[model samples]
Target: MSFLDKMFASIGIGAAKVDTILANDRLVAGDEVNGRIVIQGGKIDQDVDDIYLKVMTSYEQEIDDKKVHKECVVGKFRLTERFTIKAKEKREVPFSFELPIDTPISYGKTRVWVETGLDIKNAIDPSDRDYIEVHPSPLMSKVFNAVTDLGFRLREVECEAAPFHARRRLPFVQEFEFVPTKGEFRGRLDELEIIFLETNRNYLELLIQVDRKARSIGGLLSEMLNLDETNLRLTITNDNAHNIKDMLYQVIKKYS
Candidate 1:
């Protein structure tokens, strides 16, 4: 290759590029993701130091009272170490990943994607992004459905910075917001927020934030002081998942 050619490749103008093709874009949490990454070589052979695939999602963060959206990596997979692709060569790498139980589901404004990159020595890395939809886990679906069964409608689902009280492995936590459409608790409660902290084969640890509707001057004062919001930690097990409606009702009742 000529000097100019080498310069162009080094700058990634004519360098090897990576593209990730997921077998399916829609998946449920706790399910397996299968995909193939295609690497296309340019005018000259390219030495790849490594290849990395990252699973990430977007979340909102508050900075100086201003909300900004940001991407958070949920998982990462390394595909290769010290590989080379000859001139005009094409290579495909197959992969499988088990989506974690706490993977954020596609709800409201939340979005997730897989990013593949070719790590080239002294060269700009070429990358590709493929978006995917993640649905609720069986356990999550059960609890969320119970809310609807209790006359509550799903209002919004979003990921935000985790509060200190809520221990989380990830920097951000997914919260499902709901409003009672018709029920005894309808007028008394303003909103209900549910955050799943962690889950296992036998149990699910969750955090709940209840916001009550202010009915008097004292209540309004408490609301402005952040006292009207109550946070609770609840652990539900496979044996008692059916009682989610009752459990949530009791919590709201207390705050109402």
Candidate 2:
């Protein structure tokens, strides 16, 4: 190769490009995502050291008392080992990975996407980003329906930096916020916040926080300090999906 050709490829001019095609972009949490990576060679041959995929999302973090969104990887996987593409070559590699069960749903400002990248020595790495729509798992879907059934409206949803006690495999947690509009707890509780802690084919685990309405000056002060919030960890199984509304009502009522 000529020196000019190498220099141009190193700067990503006439360098190999990559694109990812997903079989289905709309899927529920825990589902297997199938896709293929397409690499198209440019004017010169290139040796790729490796191929990688990252499941990415953003979360709100308070830096200097200012809330800003930052990117975080939920999962990463490898597609292939070192490979060489000849000039003007076209290559396709199939790949599949299980979506992390705790992946934040594409609700509110939360977005999830797959990032495919090619690692090249002494050359700019080319990457492709494809956004996907993730839905709640079956049992988790039931939980949301139950909350709405109880006359609660989804007010806001966001993925926030996880507290030390709540951190799992991920540094952040997706929180679903709800407000009582026409229920018994409407006058008693201020709001409800829920986080999906874990999920499996058989069950869904959740951390629920109940914010009660302040009744006095002391209560108001406690609320401001986040002391009046009650946290509960509940697990709903496939068997409980049918009675989720009553089960949720009973549990939340105890706290509200």
Best by TM-score: 2
Which structure among the candidates has the greatest lDDT? 2
242 in model 1: Cα distance from truth in Å? Answer: 2.1
lDDT of 1 by residue, 1-256 (tens): 8888778999988888788889999998767899899999988888898888888898888999999998888888887778888888999999998876677889998898888888888889999999899887667888888778777889998999876766477888888999989878788888888888887556788788888989999999999998989999888888888887788778777766
Candidate 1 CA-lDDT value: 0.85
Deviating ranges (above 4 Å) for candidate 2: none
lDDT, residue 152, model 2: 92
Tens digit per residue, CA lDDT, model 2, 174-244: 99999999969888889999898988878888899999989899989988999989999988899878988
What are the clash counts of all predictions, listed in order?
A: 0, 0
lDDT of the candidates, in the order given: 0.85, 0.91
TM-score of 2: 0.96
